[model samples]
Target: MRATAEPAIAVTRQLGRFIATSSWLDIPVDVRREARRTLVHWIACAIGGSTHDTVERAVRAQLAMSNHGNARLFGRRERLVPASAALVNGIASHVLDFDDTQLGATNVHPTGPVASALFALAEIRPLSGAALAHALVLGIEVECRLANAVFRHANRGWHVTGAVGSLGAAAACAKALALEEQQIAFALGTAATQVVGLREMFGSMCKSLHTGRAADNGLTAAMLAAEGYTSADAAVEGPQGYAQVLNGATDLAGVVGALGQRYEISRLSYKPYACGVVMHPTIEACLRAREARPDLSARATAITLRVHPDVLSATGKQSPRTGLETKFSVYHAAAVALVHGIAGEDAFSDAMAVDPHVSAVRGRVRAQPDEAVRKDEVHATFSLPGETIEEHIDHVVGSVTRPMTDADLERKFESLAGEVLGASRCGRLLERCRGFEEISDAREVLAAATA
Candidate 1:
């Protein structure tokens, strides 16, 4: 008789145990702080992007399918079923491309998927802020580890956020359900089979939809597992599993080795600019150049940015026609930053993308990919009539090495959420997020965010 294939090592089960057993108290003080920051940033992005045409259409679509339910959308008056809410909120959170990034091919917008699912599930049943925080931390820990494992080796064009997000979202939802190891493992497996996202979708509304789908599907997987649904426990590591098929490799060892001991959520960073995280350093260089020469944009004949090789691959759009496309254009980000001294939501608008002054500078801007350049660092030179001005960044703002302060995050929340919710109500929501762990019902935060 032919020998049968042995089961893959217990990668899914181990992660399940870690997530299942983890509690709010088990999270270190610093990790908890980071979790709150993640919430603040994610809520800000969701509320801010909530007004975007992409989010509006998505909400309209969801509303048409089912007009009324319990779960709340960030900045809208409408309510949706939990899964639909997760999908819509996830899309709104990421529609601005301002959501947090894990910095790599794993552009895993850590909390957008996990927290979106968690918050949506919170509405289905009462969950404490503490539980929300704990689940968020553990879920992201699972997500970054899984995304990191396959993203590097995965086929180019696979967006890691869409590929591994459902896995993390499932973990968080499973944790919220307080499922034991077997059920949690099943949830992970079911989610792993649902991976979706394409790098080709980067410059379109579909990019935000990827995150929405991840949140929706991940929540469905966990709820199914909670109801005794079954799936291959070795889905992440089996011979023809997610890893092998998606990337041909799985870091089973790394996935489980540091769980609980080291928290991945702490590594998450917020964004200062509303664009791809890789373009931040380049924008920083441009801003610095402009600051040094107040008339930099007016005088600089040509601008060149030297960034990590991945920058070009990720944000290489030299000429873009819309706001969403500009988020993936290093050239545009640099040009706009220099010309307007702004990188806020207004800077990447369709009108801004086609602005005469911005377009003129954008065309002259060039990005040279360098293997030696780090993702958080960039080099730039500005051509002047008689001399050249240069700027080099050791580390960009909002990077882990230079994290945004709590106050900075609050201001960001105020800025984004204020416009949508109005100043008074937005301030209340900001306060709720800042004191998230102290709240009794996590859904209160959602209730507070709606206009």
Candidate 2:
């Protein structure tokens, strides 16, 4: 008899089973702590971005079509259905591009999709903090692992956050509902079929829409599955399925190997600057160079940056006209970081982008890409009248090597949410997030976050 190949294991079914069977106690204490950090960071980002013009327009558009529900819109006074709330909150969390990022070959904002969907579901149904945390860990793990499995997903111009994010949202929602393994598999299948987002949408409001849509779509998928919706068991690995169609190749082991031995959530990195992750090293180097020679700005003849080649592809915009465009401009980030000594959300505004000082500085700054440079490393030099001051950063401030402290996260939260929620409320909200596992109802945290 001819040798026969064993049947392929269904990636979607395997992942769904893992998510379905996993419990809060199975999660590591460190993973659980990171989950709380992810939630706190996401909540702050959502609230901070809630008042943006993009969010205002989005809310208005959603209100026109949505029926009222019990879910609270973070940082706002209005309420919407869980689906709509997820959409809005997801957009808000990412509008500023300041949310946490997973550092690897494939970069995705794991929290935006998972946290957005999970919180929306919590509002509709009661869930303990432990339940919420477990779902979050599983959701991020699935999205990031899938991202790792797909070779060059970003190189093909597919925003992994929006494309793979749908699957993450589905897993989180399925876990939150305590669905059976089969139902969870169906949910992943349904969500996989609806993957949305394109890299072409970068530097526009539509980019944020990708995150929002992923959250809404995933939640909807899980809801349908709970009601006995049926979909392909091999939705992710089947012929012409997500991995094959989207990435052109798949690494099944990356998705399935060491399933519970390591947690991807622990590898998450928060952003100190409110822009693309690739620009962090450049910004950090520029900021340090400026500090070394405060007078360099006035006497400087030129500013030059040597960075990883990937930086230009992602944030190469030299002359950005708007704040949104500035987020994708490495030149603007370096300029503002040096001129203002900070790169917070305020530093990436339309006014800052067009400010005469920032524009002049950015115009003089030049970037050269070197293949040898790492993503988290940058070499920046400031040319002055007499001499040049050079600064090199081996590891960016927010990388896993130099992770943000709890105090740092708290400060960042206050900077983003204090204006909307007031300092006292922000403090309380921070405490509530830190003690997340003890909370009886996740809704209380959401209530505290709202204005």
In order, the Cα lDDT scores of the candidates are 0.88, 0.88
**After superposing candidate 1, which stretches have Cα over 4 Å from the reference?**
1-8, 153-155
TM-score of 1: 0.97
RMSD (Cα, Å) of model 1 = 1.5
What is the TM-score (0 to 1) of candidate 2? Answer: 0.96
> What TM-score goes with each of the models?
0.97, 0.96
Candidate 1, after superposition: displacement of residue 35 in Å?
1.0
Q: Where does candidate 2 clash, by residue pair? A: none
lDDT tens per residue, model 1, 131-160: 888888888888898877777554667788
- Local accuracy of candidate 2 as per-residue lDDT tens digits, 157-236: 88889988999999999999989999999999999999988887878999899999999999999999999999987889
- Top-TM-score structure, candidate number: 1
Instruction: Write down the worst ten-residue block by lDDT for model 2.
Output: 1-10
Model 2 lDDT at residue 281 = 93
Model 2 off-target regions past 4 Å? 1-7, 151-154
Q: Provide the lDDT at 21 for model 1.
A: 78
